[model samples]
Target: MVMVMVVMGETATPAHAEPAAAGSLEADGNDEVLTSKFTYYSGRTLADPSKTMIFSGNGNVPLAEDIAKYLGVSLGNMNVSSFADGECSIKVNENIRGKHVILVQSTCPPSVNDSLMELLLMISTMRRSSAKTITVVMPYCGYARSDMKRGRERSPIAARDIMTMIETMGADRLVCVDMHSGQMQGFLSPAVPSDNITAIKVGALYFAEKMVNVPDSASEDAPRRNVVVVAPDEKAVSRAKEFWNVLIEKGVPEARFAMVLRKPNLEEQERKEQPQSAAAVSATSVDTDPSTALEHEIVGDEEAIADCDAIIVQDIIDSGQSMSNAASALKAGGARNVYGFATHGLFSRDALERIDRAPLDHVVVSNTASHPIGYEDKPTDKITWISIAPLLAEVLRIISEKESLNPVFRLPKEQQ
Candidate 1:
């Protein structure tokens, strides 16, 4: 939907009134930065001309628009609404028959269930309309936290359940951002084409330009450098390594890397010690402890974290517990600056509050998940939001060309 806002006529027009030309940045004598166009195409014609269509689901339309802009395309017309009984309804205004359709949606807060249901319905509609292929571009997978099952739990793995529903609803392919677990990628059935694109490169570029203070002549094994990449826990080693690799590509050779190990917090241990009947345990009582549920220990390169800037890298920051613990531990280990990067910032209840009390200088997250209202209004808070649209657009453009996504990761030439 195009924005229609009332503006006073005769207001002074800015120098950037005209759109910038594609693939260039202009500056009006150091006064303002004007971008002619933000795009990700590689000058390749579509394999099937006019056969590619992009649609926006109910959630996060602004992000979808950004992606469309990156592709130099407009969003396909679609009317999405609800019935009186809370049932989802949709009407496609453009012809998508026999077309390669990409539906952009992020199952984030406010109404995850409704957003997911609408996405499923849209896929089914497109499939019934003879769409050649339907790809669901979900930046934030809603049930990702429940990717694994607990001991003796009777319920199905929610992440798998969501994937099964999408595949069964006639979706031909799926594209998602940083998921909860890499193992979740294996759960996809053999027929469905899936890709778990990440924003680590995006975050690394930001840190390299704005945060890195490394020297150019440093060696690759400079483990005791000024800036260090940290994995909040063992589970995040791979993510931290990816960020480190991108930083290296961006010319931060002195940047080092480390990983943290977590031990259960005192409060969590106490709760575990208390005996409870099966009925009480089944009630899912909430733990009210304000402290992090875990304590961090530097498991790799302890010397690298001593008296240096530390950047914690992780895929998801749900409760911010592990982040909080890692920040405290890094500070206690004599780290001068503590920053964090999480691809998806779920920031569930009191997560911001917890981060406020932690020793972190800034927690940078991508716009894969929506920010809560007033998140930036706090007097002493540091939460930065980055856009993952360009990365998504690049991947989508590659997929549309029937090309492999291996180049996005800077893989070896033979692999590509």
Candidate 2:
């Protein structure tokens, strides 16, 4: 093969990492100030000397341009169109033989069709052209939720199938934002440089800023005190640890770190014996009943929720039925302020509307998953969005410099 990725726009050179203490991964003492990562390096988009191919999907055009502007390389030649026969058509306006071709696309909504078709065609075209290296940057990766097969006689794992498709199509490397699970990369070919990047630091900084504004919001006695990070489900415990580490680096005392043990929701017997429906219809309003609160019914542990004043929630996915149920439990238990922090905000089936109805004080999801349409603004709703552009741009810069990604998190946001 060949290396032909959808093009990521070329941008300016990355900065050098200053020297640090010895024997520390902190600093490798490697100082080589560089400009751009491309083998045919230059600053202007239309002026690069190398035959690099930079192509962008309609959704990812802006990001591709940002990355291109960051790498200081000229854009490659590409023309995408729809034929009269209702088939997507593409023409390579430039030669890419033995050249590194980069392709950029966002696998967001309409993911199955637009993302799949666009990426496949782009890769197949570059592969046929014998490009040297092909890298793909999917900022909002779709089909990621299908990372695992929960039921049946073992059909294809969606994530594996997708990676295989890309690999078979001629992708030498892969880059995507917060995957459903980071370990999913292991299923792909080892030769493929698959980087599953995250932006916990960005979230941590946002949390820090929020803490500074309200000193005693999440904690009382120690206003500057750190709060526990919680994973709503057992599957997300790993992310909770990663988020805790980032908080530590951001100045949260280690003693404050804790993971809420994820327990199963009430099963059939527990609900039947508890007089669940009776409580909803009697003694309280309709809103108090878990079954009537959202479209789906739920019963959570109020003890677990009320114990914590503030919680750093890991995710809000899977119809948000669980989150809403859990939120009700928290309100009953004792949590004063409940805040959710997730890399992806996949609010499905009227989830945003229901979340607004919950007692939660704040919910923050990155700009990674398109902000859930109208979630940016709503009456009686508090939702904040953080950008992962800096984090992703940093990864590209480090890859170009042949540097380790350890420093990527430490680099200041302004530099990223």
lDDT of 1 by residue, 1-416 (tens): 22221111121212222322221122212211211222232433335447788887767776776676666666788888777678788788778888889888888876789889988998988998899999899999998888877876667789988998999989888898888887777778989988988778767766765557333235745443477899888888888999998777666787888877877568867876688787776443323333442355787677877888889999888777788878888888889889998888878766777778788887778888766545646523377666666668778888887788887665332210
lDDT of each: 0.72, 0.58
Task: State the TM-score for model 1.
Answer: 0.79
- Can you write out model 2's per-residue Cα lDDT over 207-267, one digit (the tens) per residue? 6444422344435554453255666656666776676665666566531433333344476
Question: For model 1, what is the alpha-carbon lDDT of residue 253?
Answer: 81
Q: Which stretches of candidate 2 lie over 4 Å from their true place?
A: 1-53, 72-77, 81-86, 94-98, 151-154, 212-214, 217-222, 254-309, 315-318, 371-381, 409-416
State the local distance difference test value for candidate 2. 0.58
The Cα RMSD of model 1 versus the native structure comes to 7.2
- Candidate 1 local distance difference test against the native: 0.72
Q: Ten-residue segment with the worst summed lDDT in candidate 2?
A: 31-40
